[model samples]
Target: MILEVLQLVPHPDTPAKAVPSVLCSLSWQDAGHWVAGFIVGAPSEALALPTPTRPARTDGLWQRTCFELFLRDPESGAYLEFNFSPSGEWAAYRFDGYRAGMRPLELADPWITSTDRDQFNAGMGAHLAALGLDPASIGTLLSTPMPEIPGAPAAPAQYVLNAHLEDPALGAAKTWQLGISAVIEEADGTKSYWALAHPEGKPDFHADACFALEMAMSR
Candidate 1:
């Protein structure tokens, strides 16, 4: 039997052991528009997520291939989870506690806004400062237009950060923390979970103990 591989999940396995799944990533523009990027090398005929004729709020989407978002308010201690199936069907739930006080939440697709160079850099600097970092300690910010690179995506979803972070929240990582994830469904109806960082022993997207991807802002 011949099996094709999907690049949606950033598995640690070698290409030889890579399974049929998609590699998914997401980027949000400072609470503006959030966009998801999926690296699906395998053709639809080979591997496809569930897509319904009419997209609607439906349950059991997670049992299949689906995109998800988890947002939380640190002050209010309330959070929301959103599920989006490739089929256009979606669902959302609100929780006042971990796996508690479940309720339905309404939402619409957020616009995908382009990040301007200046605005992006300024936001970066502001966030660093908010974390009590000296402006001089930070590396030189991107001050000019970036030259094109080979094999670069037609549109990039992530930013190229060359600065180092020295905070308790982020000891030295060079990326933002936000909650984003996906479940890739196999032809036989199996699934695997993927996220920015799964700290728990098992797959738990709602694990607010850490961030999948957190939005940063300046006061």
Candidate 2:
């Protein structure tokens, strides 16, 4: 596997650190095509938690490879950590945060095997089952309009919002009006797409970042 270094940025928040602020972009390229890759960067000084050996799949569009640094709290033997997905999502994990004696909650979804259609279906099926939902009933529920979440105003079927990007090292920045969408994919391999936008901007510091992608065939 050939992994190319696309971009690198020094850490702005911390100085005198051996690991200069780093930002990298990577992609999988084969047969003269770029499949998908994401940006990875160090977010803070806190140690990273151990990454799970089993990868997770989300929405069937992207695959993620992750790495973390783990730290421990002396008093409780419990710890807090930072996690980075090569696909660009960063999150903080606390062993005990929300409820008493509960496991940490993942704030984002990182899906793998986007190009493998069959695996995608199976992954989605497993997700639905975990939700205690019957895949067979999704169709009927979609046909009937449902009420909005309590205390929230109803929104249009579609929505739009502004997006922005900022990075001091690269001297790069962007502002744009964008649309959001969502879709449902059935067990039979059908899909639906929708659009909506959030008030917050989606910032990507590694937009132009680049990296090499390769797979090991055989010995």
Candidate 3:
């Protein structure tokens, strides 16, 4: 699923009042894994990023510059939330229902690609070009290699998400609505919310069932 940042709600002090369009894409990996990639077409130039820290689980990563993924369980109505900060800080939270039973969700094999900014692009390019986007975000765990994406760019993308889970009911053959979004914070502390589809009213991502696409597990 590819979500275009249409409603880029920026703060009054936002550096880019009219930030260019941002594209966020998601993929489902073996059995129950997920990979989400985010790229900003507006400004590929380096923005003042938050301080780099060892990749670890930390809360409130979303309050600053971060990328997020939301997954809903059709059977129990439970949901999982993940936060990826450009600084290499990450966090995961699970809820029994909408805004309920909030707790840390242990992530297996979670990794970050933003540690070495210098080689970020080169690494991403090579990773995506060779393996395509399928497992690039997650690493090599695919039982069946993903088919190359036609006409995909040669350069590597900056932000991509990788996650995995195991569920018997919601199998690979069935597709589900995936939510992809980004929270950008400028040097001056201006914040903005971007996504493929934003519902009416405030910038709450939980609403509108923001199911941007019927994404399935495949190439």
What C-alpha lDDT values do all the predictions have? 0.50, 0.28, 0.56
Spell out the clash pairs found in candidate 3: 32-165, 33-164, 34-163, 36-161, 124-156, 125-156
Better-scoring candidate (lDDT), 2 or 3: 3
lDDT of 2 by residue, 18-71 (tens): 222222223222312221222222222221222222334222221222322222
List candidate 1 segments past 4 Å from native: 1-32, 109-177, 217-219
| Rank order (by TM-score, best first) | 3, 1, 2
Instruction: Kindly state the number of residue pairs that clash in model 3.
Output: 6
- Candidate 3's C-alpha runs over 4 A off are 1-18, 42-46, 115-174
Q: Candidate 2: lDDT of 14?
A: 18
lDDT of 1 by residue, 56-158 (tens): 4688878876667666666555676777665555677887866789888655432111133443444455545655787456446456566898998775332
- Tell me the lDDT of model 2 at 98: 18
- Given candidate 3, what's the lDDT at residue 32? 58
Lowest lDDT 10-mer window, candidate 1? 158-167
lDDT of 2 at 46: 26
- How well is each residue in 53-119 modelled by candidate 3, as lDDT tens digits? 5556788887876877777666566777778776666777887877889998865525555434533
After TM-score superposition, the amount by which residue 36's alpha carbon in candidate 2 deviates from its true location, in angstroms, is: 8.0
